[model samples]
Target: MTTTAAAHTDLDGTLPPLAEPWDPAEFETRLRAVGEERYHDRHPFNVRMHSGDLSPSELRRWIGNRFHYQRHIPVKDALITAKLDTPALRRMWLRRIQDHDGPAEGEGGIERWLRLGEAAGLERQAMLRGDTVLPGVRLAVDGYVNFCRLRSPLEAVAASLTELSAPDLMRARIEAFERHYPWIGTEGLAYFRSRVSQGRRDSREALDLVLAWARTRDDQERAVAALRFKCDVLWSLLDAVDAAGHREPA
Candidate 1:
C-alpha cells in the first residue's frame, strides 16, 4: 500500500482532524470503513487461500509465519491490560490474555495454532521458537506489540478493532480449509472455530471502550489512525508471505 504524504499528514502528523466530534454511530461507521478499505482479508494471499489456489508450501509457510503473530496476541493484550487504569477494565482485558493463553497447559489459542502448524507439516517445537518466521513477518508483528506498549490506552484498544472483521474471515477460512485442504484435519481447525465467537465478543468490548473513551475530535482521529496502523501491520504480514512464495527455491 502506498503511503502518500496526504495520508500521513491529514491529521497534521500528530492527530487526525475531525470537522466535529462524531456521534457513536458515525465513529463506528468510520472505523468499519477503515477495515473495509485496508483489512488483510483483501490481501491477494488471503484471496488465493480462500480460493483454494495456494500451494502446500505456501500454506505451510503462512501457518508457520503466522504462528509468530499468534503467540504475540496475548503479549500485546498484556500491554493493553497494563495500560488500563481501573481494576474492572483490567479484569475485562485479562480475559483476552486468558483466551489466547488459556488457564492450563495444552490449551488456548496459541496451542490451537500450534496444532494448525502441525497439521500443515510444521514442527511444533520449531514454530514455538519462531525459527521459520520471515523477517518481514517478524518486523510487522513486533511493530504491533510495540505499538500497543507505547500508544495511549484508548488508541491501543482501537487498534484491536480489527477483530471486527475477524469472525467473517474465520468462517471463510474454516470452510476453505475443509473444502480445499482436506489434508489438514478438522481437529486443526479448532482455532478458527473458537475465534468466531471470541472475535465478536472481543471486538464488541473493544469498540464500546473506544466509543466511550474517545470523546474529543482529536481522540477519535487518533483512534482511527491507530486502527489504520493495525491494518497496515496485518497487510504487511501477508505482503511478506506473498513475496516469499514468489522467490526462487534455493
Candidate 2:
C-alpha cells in the first residue's frame, strides 16, 4: 500500500497500536535521537561552514537568511506562552521571549544577529527588512511559527526542545567563525556565544516540561514527532540555503 494508505489504515486501527509509553529516560533518549539523526548541524551548508569552505558572500548570505529565523524566535515563544494555561508555565516560558527580544532597545538575540549581519558586510537596514532573504528560508521559518501557534502546548514545548542540541552547534560555530572567518569581527560571535549557555538552560526547562506532561503513549509519540518536525524545519532551512546557492562574487 502507499504511504498515505498506510497512515489511514493505522488511524483506522487496521495496524497495531504503537508500543506502550516509554519511561521518562527512554522518552528523553528517543527525543534526543531525533536530533542526532536529523539536526541541521549535519547539513551541507554547516559542514562547509565548519570546514572553512564557504566564501565571504556565502557566509553573508547565511547570516542574512538566518536573521529571518532569528527575528521570529520571540514570536514563536510568545505563541507557545499563549498556549500555556498555567501561570507557572506561562511565567517559565516567558523567559524565552525576553532572551530573544530583551527588555530594551538594542539588546537581545535579534539585535545580536543583526550585528552579525553587519559584520558579514550586509547593510543593517536591508537585513532588518529581510527583502533579500531566500523564499525557502521565509517559508520554513513561517511554518515553524505556525506550528507553535497551532499545535498543542505540550507538542509546541517539545518542538522547542531542539534547543537540546543547539549548544554544541553554537560552540562549534563560534570556533569555526573565529578560526576561519576572522575578518567577520569578534562582536559578531557574540550571538553564538550567548546561545551556548542559553541553549542548555532552555533545553533543560523544555525537557522537564515535556517529561512532566507527556504521560501517555500517544502523548510521548506526539512529543517525539514534534521534536522531529522541528528538526526537519531547521534542516529544510539549510536545504533552502543550499539550493539558493552560495553567494556569488560581486
Candidate 3:
C-alpha cells in the first residue's frame, strides 16, 4: 500500500487548504535548497577557515567557543529521544546521543572535540570550564538547545538535516587543515575525519525520517523552515565567532 499525507488536518485553526504533500523528490529538493542557501558553510568565518586565512588565535577562539555546541548536542538529542513515539525510534535516536557522549568518558565526539581544543592550544580545563566561550557564542548555542527542546519532534529531526551537507564540509575541512593549518597537527583532524562518515550516515537517516514523517503540506513547510532555522543558528554562531571580541564584555 502506498503511504502519503493523511487527509486535510489544518495545523492551525484557520484550516489552510489541504494541499497534497510534495512529491518525495520535490520535497527533498526543497530541503536541499535550504542548505544551499542558508547553511553555515556559506558563512564568512567558515569561508575564511576553509581558505586557511584565520590566524591561530582566531582558530583557537572558534574551537573554544564551539565546545559548548559540541557538548550540548547529546543533550538536545536526549530530549528528542524522550519525545520519540516508539521504542525502536528512540533506540535509533539514542545512538546520536551515544555518538557524542559515549558509554564511557574519554570517548565519543565530545572527547574528540576536546582533543581538537588541545591541538588548537586551548587548555582542556579551560574549554571544559567554558572560560573562553564568548557570550555571543554561548547565546547562539543556547538558542539551538532551546530550539530542540521546544520544537515538535518532527521539526527537531528536520533541524538536524544540517548533517546532510556536513560530510563534504568535513572533507574540505580536513584538506584545508592539512594544507594550510599545519600547526594544528594531524591528530587534530580526527574529529573532522570521523565526521566524514558519521555525517553521511546520520544525514541519510534524518533525511529518510523527514521525508516520511512530513506527511502534509504544512508539515513539509515546517520541516523546511526548521532546516532553515538550524542553518541560521549555525550562521549566527560563525558571525559571533568571527567578529572581533575585544569590545564584547566577558
- On residues 1-250, what C-alpha lDDT tens digit does candidate 3 reach at each position? 7754543445654545667889999999999999888888888889989999888888898899888899999999998898899999999999999989977988899999999989988999999999877778788878888989999998999999999999999999999999999988898888899899999999999999999998899999999999998998888888888775545565
Q: Give the CA lDDT, 0 to 100, for residue 100 in model 1.
A: 91
- For model 1, the stretches where C-alpha displacement exceeds 4 angstroms are 1-18
lDDT of 3: 0.89
Per-residue error (Å), model 1, residue 18: 8.3
Counted clashes in each candidate structure: 0, 0, 0
lDDT of each: 0.94, 0.90, 0.89
Ranking by TM-score: 1, 2, 3
Instruction: Give the CA lDDT, 0 to 100, for residue 178 in model 3.
Output: 94
What is the TM-score of candidate 2? 0.91
Quote the RMSD, in angstroms, for model 3: 5.9
- Which candidate has the top score in TM-score? 1
Candidate 2 C-alpha lDDT tens digits along 132-246? 8998998999999999999999999999988999999998999999999999999988999999999999999999999999999999999999999999999999888887773
Worst 10 residues of 3 by lDDT: 4-13
How well is each residue in 127-206 modelled by candidate 1, as lDDT tens digits? Answer: 98878789999999999999999999999999999999999999999999999999999999999999999999999999
